[model samples]
Target: MTAVAAGTALLLTGCGLGGAPATAPVDTGGKVEGTITFQTMQLSPTFDDYLNATIDAFEAKYPGTTVKWTDIPSNAAARKVSADAIAGTLPDVMDLDTGTLAPLGRKGLTVDMATAAGDVKDSYVATAWQSFAFGGTGAAALPWYLNTPVLISNKAVLGKAGLGSSPDPTGYDELLTRSAQIAKATGVAGFQPTETGFANSLLTVGVPLVDETATKAVVNTPEAVAFVTKLAELYRSGGIPKDSVSAKERSEIETFSEGKTAYLESGGSRLKIIKENSPAVFGSVAVGKPLGDAAKRTWVVAHGLAVPTKSGNLPTAVAFAKFLTSAENQLALAKVSSVFPSTTASLNDPFFAVGDGDLTAAARRIAATGLRDGRTTVKPPAADAEYGATLWSAVQPAILGDVAPAQALGDAEAKLTKILQERQK
Candidate 1:
């Protein structure tokens, strides 16, 4: 199988569905009817099709409701959402990142979703629910889906490293050392940290880049100092090649499949990609619980629902948002999309009770044990923001040893500080 056969594209974890949010309450369980326009991207092939199927099922149940969806390439969704907002012609329902929500909400372009999201609010996991920052209690913008990032490992690689199945690594120190050994012995990329793996971009590496509490960015701090130092050491040690800086989704996925890398970072949809594209690689791949230590927050990405303040079908949109994210629906979607659901009960489903593959087991690990209690939380750095671009510019050099760690960090910090502070002013 190949990427074409697997229908591979971008698999967005932390699709930014959950983030800063607002809440409102309204009552409507009867005959919900209206045409809602939605937008999706090139990232996930199933997004539009799955939504349309859901819309059909919903219309059948509700009788009079209708939904119209539009496909905007993933790269275009942001701009499309913005253009709609300006034209005063917005979809009744659409997906936007959490950061985007802050601006839209502040601009009064988004209404609180808690209004018609009662059942939805009740079903999703707490932290997942919290992502929306739904209106406190009994009030929230309905939640849509979730993205749980985990380490997808080639179990076979572990054997070569003289290690058994992956152990719970203690920290970045152990993690890097293991990868280094794997590379040196096998002549392969020991630990693969793809550009796609931004799970650590903000919270893990960015903690030092930004302020201590996360309200500010000091990316050039000692923490960044530590991060880049390890990165430079690994790069110079010949851990990974420099060509991967511009590689996209399938490249990293394919490399792991070819045994060129021992470990790679990915989310729920990765399992699907392997299953459909590279069956051989899929068989060799195994999953590990999220990597990191107590010092870092577990990376969590949830997709929630919101009403564009400009939505014409606000009431009906609220109803579907609630219905789609309900406990039953959450479970149902897991089967269709091959990703984890945002609700706790979904994990107990027999479908997830048994580990089928790296994809299945890893997603279940995150859903059942990782953040199920809401004790661990992770947020993506403002990746689509200037902070992201600054880090991107520095990641390659820092990881590949093109520049010194201190110099790379200094340049990144200066650029990022200037970038983030610009928005404040």
Candidate 2:
């Protein structure tokens, strides 16, 4: 799994959908003063100081407002939120992502941030803000932190393949060609796709997953079929590892760190993990722009602050949500982590522009450039997991050369179209 997939998995596991319709939005007319519960996903011991300090500052700003902070393990957060929603005891303010916020927004459990706080809309990147908007629910949360994938390569592996230590591929085709040569020469896999699956892979190559109305799947086109065929050929030729066809993100990292793979596409935040787990491999890694349309259509993952519609103190909750995502607070967090701030002004900080000629710094600089065009690429109105599962199940056979590429994609399109139709009803 790449860092992006690992982070996404953490968020997705915590997003549980409920069947009940929620209460209407709270009136936003009162003073921003009250005791409000705040919940966070998996930011505990390591960030205890920063979070407490921020909470203290918020309380100071709004005298009389007492903020109660609770941090939950990422795997347990979704269930806690769902249980609270059922009991009508949801936190006034919660940290959430697009996946966790979607079903709640659909059921009217969250405040319409875009409507209640429309004046602050321009404070965030347009795509980041839009990510929280679901069908007819308006924007459900305030955009917070974000990350985009960057290309990381092993110079030693590339050199062994006779490509220069710093060879750069202009696009995916060239990258694949180089990967094949590296595998043949060095007896190592050249690349490994994240276990999160290939939906993003198709999207990165210009394959439209849905039609204009989002009412049909249109990925059974010639371009998609050709891509799948190429992937199968690559798999058969040993350019991609056999176990990687079903391995998790951790496996992908291990493979790369062990020098079994030459390239990896992951969030820059992962550089620290590599440095800690495999110092030798980390020393040889180089950061560069993502290949192909990925450079132009970078996949972004964003987390946000949400206020439940049932909060006892809606005004205070919303106020804190805005304060937490403000340019100043966001930059403070970004300065200490690999995440980029959603606020436009935060990106202008010199820290993002400066590189110290090291792997981590280079990755941060490259990722910030990609963030200007970054967006959440595969957002279906409903049944997002089902959509990915359908694609993976249908495409896996073709990738293993057990089914024809065209037939596999045709089946996937048919199944995805049915899913879209069912969602419409």
Candidate 3:
């Protein structure tokens, strides 16, 4: 899938239709003895062994309960979930993204995680838990794993450009300077920042998309205009890809994988693909801090599991969900894939801190520590997709040199303000 900005594709696990969270109260003293179907988001084959082992462990703990696991294709998963919701046949437990889960929560189809998870709640990272909890009504899903963005460098290419192996630019200004240097020497794009849209730029610089109350657009400040304008200048100077203004993640990924760019801001998970498809490039890989205007935060995304409020085996389903996200189970999954666990216990495991002195391990360690200070770049209203699209459309022209940055941002702010106001109604 084309990775947009950090927060555009978020999902929220939620309660049923009445704006009231559905209760999935744990029956700790009761017996769990029914079959519960657990649907996953395209996690089969690659994670088959680890998942099967986790399921086996859960079943062993509760002899009479059976977990019927199902894996859905990523493209079909959301639609299938929606269809199932309409038909009242959503699996007992299912994994969802923030975007898919948010609407479901608003409809109150999913049960509240606060009532479902028992004492196991304290084990999770507070931010991860709060993110799924929406408005602090308690989480509706258990954060399973995270994918945080990191700065990756092709050392060989960067060395040719006179930049260090692990280049750490302080902000967009330094980023542009370094990128222009690389582009001048190598004749390739210098920095392939995740032009997932305007949000990506704003959030990386510690600028909130909206004001504290989220009622109006606050991105028209002088700092914002300068940032956006600089990006356009970088584009013009060949510091970024020519198509960057309209480029999606695939283009950036392709450019970086083919070593056409010196620096890439991508999720830590991309390391696996590079290792497999571009071994030569992988050998010279270097991990560095995420480039931004701020020091404390970066962009992060996660995958989590949620349960339907109408499940026939509520207790068993909730129990299994907890089991799947348990520190041990999460670690098991992390051991096999590029995923990083969300649980504090899992993160504290020695394996996470132990690096083998290689770029892959170094990147993973940087990402793991960064997740502690990370957040979704933007948290748009429920009508985020519509408004986000509008905002991006309005701003792209400026970034592409079609309009002045201040004018384009002003136009986007006006449209977004109206959109937010209308959505509140």
**Candidate 2 residue 266 C-alpha distance from true site, Å:** 0.2
TM-score of 3: 0.84
Number of the top lDDT candidate: 2
Tell me each candidate's TM-score.
0.78, 0.88, 0.84
The segments of candidate 2 whose C-alpha lies over 4 angstroms from its true place after superposition are: 1-26, 165-167, 208-219, 246-250, 292-295, 373-390, 414-425
Off by over 4 Å in 1: 1-53, 60-64, 99-102, 114-122, 133-140, 165-170, 198-202, 205-215, 245-250, 272-283, 293-296, 356-368, 400-407, 423-425
lDDT of 1 by residue, 358-401 (tens): 46755665545555555346352343344454566776666666
In lDDT terms, how accurate is model 2?
A: 0.74
Clash total of candidate 1: 14
Candidate 3 per-residue C-alpha lDDT over 125-181 given as tens digits, one digit per residue, 9 for 90 to 100: 765675565433367687777666678878888788877644477556777788888
Q: Per-residue lDDT for 1-425 in model 2, tens only?
A: 10111223223224433334545656776798989999888877767887899999999999999999998877666566666776788899988766656667766779998788889999888767876876556688998888677788888888888886545775567777878888889888888865253666676677767775555898898878988888788888889887777444346677888888898887887788878879999888888887643436556667889888878998999999999999999989888777888887887778788877877878887777666545335333332455776787788888889999999999999988876654444
Q: How high a TM-score does candidate 2 get?
A: 0.88
Q: Looking at candidate 1, what is the lDDT of residue 352?
A: 69
For candidate 3, the per-residue lDDT at 18 reads 25
Give the lowest summed-lDDT range of ten residues in model 1.
Answer: 1-10
- How many steric overlaps are in each model, in order? 14, 1, 15
